[model samples]
Target: MQAEAQLAKSAILEVALQLAEKSSWDRIHLFDVAREMGVGLADIHRHFRNKDALAEAWFDLADAALLRLAQTPGWQQVPQKQRLQFAYSAWLDALAGHRRLTREMIGYRLQPEHVHLQVRGVLRISDTVQWIREVAMLPAAGWRREGAETVLTTIFLAVFARWLVDESPGTRKTQVLLGRLLVAADLGARLVAGLSLRSPASLRAFN
Candidate 1:
């Protein structure tokens, strides 16, 4: 009995996520998820007490997906330019996949418990700066060290928003432009701070 109940609840949550992705979170009724899962409505209620619970689950799911994608192998083995490009492309795919859910999720920011936005945003910015550092083969200097993360975050969000509204082909041009903009910003920050690029010592530390 316990195993069957657990399976039924998992099915409801899975179906709820799918429905939220296809339409909006608001459109994901218990009846809809239950029907899609071939389960009774009570099965969904058994897992999520109400629609809000299901919506919260959907938000969590989206956050997990973004973090996972940002940590993929393809993202790790590249120049900063390529890494940012890959990240942007991955982000676009996620947005396209969850456009409907995101629209409804956006309206829920009035709620105080919605900390996922800030948490995920900060983590992503850190990841972006790490990518830039690895590719540039250098550590940040002066105020750039403090501000590079914020600059990358701002650049990414601006590029992504433009991507969401752009009807351009493949987002290729936008990606290229954004890449140049980010590289320029990083270089400018370093120059203004009078920082010179230092070679990695592990390559030849003990001569």
Candidate 2:
């Protein structure tokens, strides 16, 4: 029974992906997914409440793949910035085969009129950043943690935007952009650390 349920869920998601590849997300309804999978509407509803939920599940699938890659040996020893690079690289690699669909979905969600989707996108980025922080074994809470999340989220969106249109082989352009951003981030961190060292009381007050 459990396996059958899982299969039904997977079929729904697979059908949704196929539909998304051919049509705009806004036009692709749960009914369409159900029909494509030859399942009852209730079956899809049993797995995903709505299109957004299904999309979030797809993101979760990608995140799971990224997390697995992050767990490989030697990943833990890398510097935080390098770890982030790896995470973002893995994420893009996972989506490479579905680049067109990804681009369409991202573009649709980010449209000015889609405020809800924009908010969801921010939340999703926040979640991804938190995951990256955990894999990097960073401190749980503090100004540094909050700052890292904000910075990493911004970097991910910026790099991801470049990645969508990037045509260079191996996504070399996106990689270069990420490398530069990381260097800038490192320098900024060093400057902040230096200032904190010079004014411990101020740092404490800010914290």
Candidate 3:
């Protein structure tokens, strides 16, 4: 009985994944997933309460895979810039591998307060950002902190957008551009802050 229950549960999730690949998440329905799974709708409900629950589970899988990648033995040994590149690259690879399904899943915004369902995905992204900062030797306390975080997130989204359509080789150009932009912005902000500290009167001198 337990084995049969587990099989039904797996079928429900599998059908949902297939539906996502074929269409948008908004179009996915529990009834349809059950139909595709060759099981009754009641069987699916026994496993997943609703479409939202399944969406959360799908993202949870993606989040777990990302955390695993981060824990690989050689991952930390890479340079900070390379680390950022790898993080983006892995996301691109995952999206590419599950392009149809991910396209739908990525569109849903999990509520910030929904800690129970969103915790793993939220922590994965947060930790990755923090890891990048630490490896770059970036100071946590500074005027640049906000700006750096903004830029990093922007670069990440931009890379994903490009990967969605880019046919270029290994996204080499895109990766290089993103890396240069981030490094330049970080260094430039730090330099400006340093100068401001040392030459506060320079502004008046210029005026």
Candidate 4:
């Protein structure tokens, strides 16, 4: 039963995507998806609350891709800075095939009327950031973890916004931006660590 339900959801999601490619995501209705699957509206409802939920499911795929790529052999051996780079790179790659459609999905969620979805979107981003930290093995805690989350959230949104419209060959532009920002973030983290490590015996004793 569990496998059947999971298969149903995957089928609905895939059918929705196929329809979206033929038409705009906003233009595709639940009826369209149901009809494509030869299932009732209740069937889709069982799998997704609505179209926005389906969009969330799509982003979930990207998160899975990022985690898989991040935890691959030797990922631990890679420099921490590059680990972050790899995370975002893998995520965007999952959406690269449907860049325009993905952009539309995000825009739909951000519409002024969808205040609840907008709020959920923010939480969704934070969840993804947490995954990035876990996969990259970032050791930040307390205030440092909070600060790191803030910095990474900003970088991800900015880079993702660029990717929504980027046409550069192989998304090199987005990758370049991600690398530069990650390196800068790493440098800032190192600087903070150095400053916080003041010797207890020194006059400026701070742990």
The CA lDDT of each predicted structure is 0.58, 0.75, 0.60, 0.82
Tens-place lDDT per residue, model 2, 45-122, is 888987877777777777887788666888756756677677778778877876777787777787799899889888
On lDDT, the stronger of 1 and 2 is: 2
Clashing pairs in 2: none
In model 1, what is the error at residue 59, expressed in angstroms? 6.4
Per-model C-alpha RMSD? 6.5, 4.5, 8.1, 4.4
Per-residue lDDT, model 1, residue 199, is 33
What is the Å distance of residue 179 in model 3 from its true position? 2.9
Which whole-number lDDT from 0 to 100 does residue 149 have in model 1?
A: 59
TM-score, per-candidate, Cα-based: 0.57, 0.83, 0.61, 0.90
Arrange candidates by TM-score, descending: 4, 2, 3, 1
State which candidate has the highest lDDT: 4
Tens-digit lDDT track of model 3 for 1-207: 999976766567767877767777768788788777777877777878877677656545544454556677776556455655665565556545565555545545455554554665565566655554544434435445666676666676676666555667866766667777667654565465565434543221110
Model 4 misplacement above 4 A:
195-207
User: Which segments of model 1 are wrong by more than 4 Å?
Assistant: 1-14, 17-23, 40-77, 107-144, 196-207
lDDT of 1 by residue, 1-207 (tens): 999876765567767777777766755678887787787877677778876665455544434444565556665445554555554555456555555455465555335676865565456546654554444333455555557656666776677556646656766666776877767775766466555566342221110
Indicate the TM-score of model 4. Answer: 0.90
